[model samples]
Target: MIKITEKSECCGCNACVQRCPKQCISMKEDEQGFLYPFVDTTSCIDCGLCEKVCPILNPFDTKEPLQVLAAKNKNEDQRLKSSSGGTFILLAEHIIKQGGVVFGARFDTNWEVEHCYAETIEELEPLMRSKYVQSKIGNTYKEAEQFLKDGRLVMFVGTSCQIAGLKRFLRKEYDNLLAVDFICHGVPSPGIWRKYLEEIKSSRSEAAGKNTVLSLSLKSVPVITGINFREKQQGGYGWKKYGFVVQAKSPSKGDKNSVLLSSIFNENIFMKGFLANLYLRPSCYKCKAKNGSANSDITIADFWGIQKSHPEFDDDKGVSVVFIHTCKGKGIIKELSSRLDLIDSNLKEATLPNPVYFRSCQEPKKYSLFWNIYKKTKSVHEAVNAATKLTFIDVIKIFLRRFYNKLRRTFKMVN
Candidate 1:
């Protein structure tokens, strides 16, 4: 029987959910909103297929990257919209151009993040920016496998666990498949996210002078009409200054609509809660897929140290640190050589800020207290503030770090 004794053992990959022959296993959400497989005892034949597909139970042999490079797409438009160097767009473009399909996470009409596939250039736009939420993977593994089996090239990009889940679900390797995983900090709780959205709605209604105050419950909020985490309205491509904005239909303002844009770090309650580790999935604190264990063909992330090592590549738009783990990844890079400006770079320097590459995120001592308060208050802001009371020194340290990075960028540009 496939059962999770410890929460940390399950990556929430959904591999077991999709691989069950009798359709006995289903992903059920716990109190924290993280999903785990539940086998229907009556239907389950004790086949152990679910256990076989569990990536955490049967780990893959880790393969070290063949080469590391810093790259950016030549297209200025693509680079600007991308969260990190538009490397993903370039890679996806290659597969699409070859009459193939690309799978990645994208926000749906209601602003909920989920994994889906794109076969055209237009569909790739939504997949450019980082969603920062744990995307629901709905049958994408099976869809990708079907495409590969049909002789169509397939490109899938996601966090390490997701890529590992796909590989495990497929059971066998396919030459037509290319897996690209990113250096992830962690996937935040979807249930917490729903609450956060409700918070936004409640605040917006209050601002709109509504006679009826919407309940501060996840079920009460109207469907989020729009969301933009990387809203550049005020920043003007100032990568350092970003905002998380959400739009909802206005009930009181006569259909004019309402918008909440929080540019300040302190005001962005959802972001603050996420960074404080108040509501991340328990498994994220001890990610089993880190350190290249996912066996992805290529791994990509922001080159955080670009200003110091490769000053020329530090254009403030975005730069990608790419690690090629297999010859197939190397060949893909070669094929896109004309579109990408690659620079041989040191992997150590590139991965300095991304700590998940080496180890999991350390659980804060206040983790339990934070969640307890969150359960009672149902307020993202109050919960985060209660959990992580940023002292004067802590605030100053954060300010100093941002100032130092900006100073370094300025100095590099002047010289």
Candidate 2:
């Protein structure tokens, strides 16, 4: 049986739970809203399968990428809808066209992120974009294994830890399996996410001159129809400084779309807390799968410093920095070359702008303080504000930084 002595030891990948032949291991959410495996000692056979399949205990060796390149989907509309360069959609479509399945993180009806599989191109929409919250990987490892066993092509896209988990669970390699991981910047608490949505609904109701008290009731509250964590269509900023958008149907408007909340990523309250490293999963602070340790076929991430590195490629649209690790990854990229505008790039430039590619984020000093406040008030806003409130000097520094960045961009454009 496996035991989680420290929270950081578990990545909530659900591999141990699925690997347990006795089915004694269960994933339970902790106070921080991250899942950790719990073993039922009575039912556990002590076969040690759980420990055998743990990615953290037995991580893969880091390997140098075969090819590093910057790529963009040729389809302009698809590129705009995606959080990055829409490379994921291309990969998923490729697998689906080959009569395969694609597993990825997507939102449930209540907006809680979960790992699910899509079999067709139409089913791939929900799997697109970025869900910053840690997704519930409910038996996805087992599901993917089944598809692979059936000799069907299976593509699994998730954080590095998740890809590691799936590979560990399978115990062997599969020619039909394509594991794609991303440059992850920690996953935030789902509990905080739920609270944030409720707060947004309450605030919107009060603004609409409706009774805020009624918002407490699920039936009376407006239904959230859509949520885009990385809405790239901000007026001037576009993909460079994407917005966070939430759309809902108002009950008073007879289920019509009435509430649309939009804010730049930096301005959004939830995003502010997330980016500040307030309430990310414990494992995120000490990720063992960073820097190609997950042994994924391919890794994709936003080309954050594309403007500085490849000025001509910076169209204010999205660009993806792709690291092809295995020959399988190279083959797929070659197949999809016609559909993407590919540019040869080096790993140094990619990692320079995105340090999360190799290193885990430092745990914020106010991490404990934020949880303490949340425990008392149960308010995501109050906890985040209290924990991350900037001093007068901090505000001035931030303003100066933004001004400097703006001026530099302007100079680059003129040159």
How many pairs collide in each candidate, listed in order?
0, 0
Q: Any residue pairs clashing in model 2, and if so which?
A: none
Quote model 2's TM-score: 0.92
Task: Give the top-scoring candidate (TM-score).
Answer: 2
Badly placed stretches (over 4 Å) of model 2 are 204-220, 234-237, 392-415
Tens-digit per-residue lDDT, 1-415, candidate 1? 7888999899888888888888888888888878888888999898888888888888777666788899888897877777777899999988999999999999886567899999999999888788878898878998998999999999999989899888888999999999999998888888887776765676542223322233333334444566767654443634444456666655444454446443434456677777777777788888878878888999998887788888977787778889999899999999988988889986687778666786788888789888899789877667777788877988999999999999999999999
Worst 10 residues of 1 by lDDT: 205-214
> Which has the greatest lDDT?
2
Q: Report the Cα lDDT for candidate 1.
A: 0.80
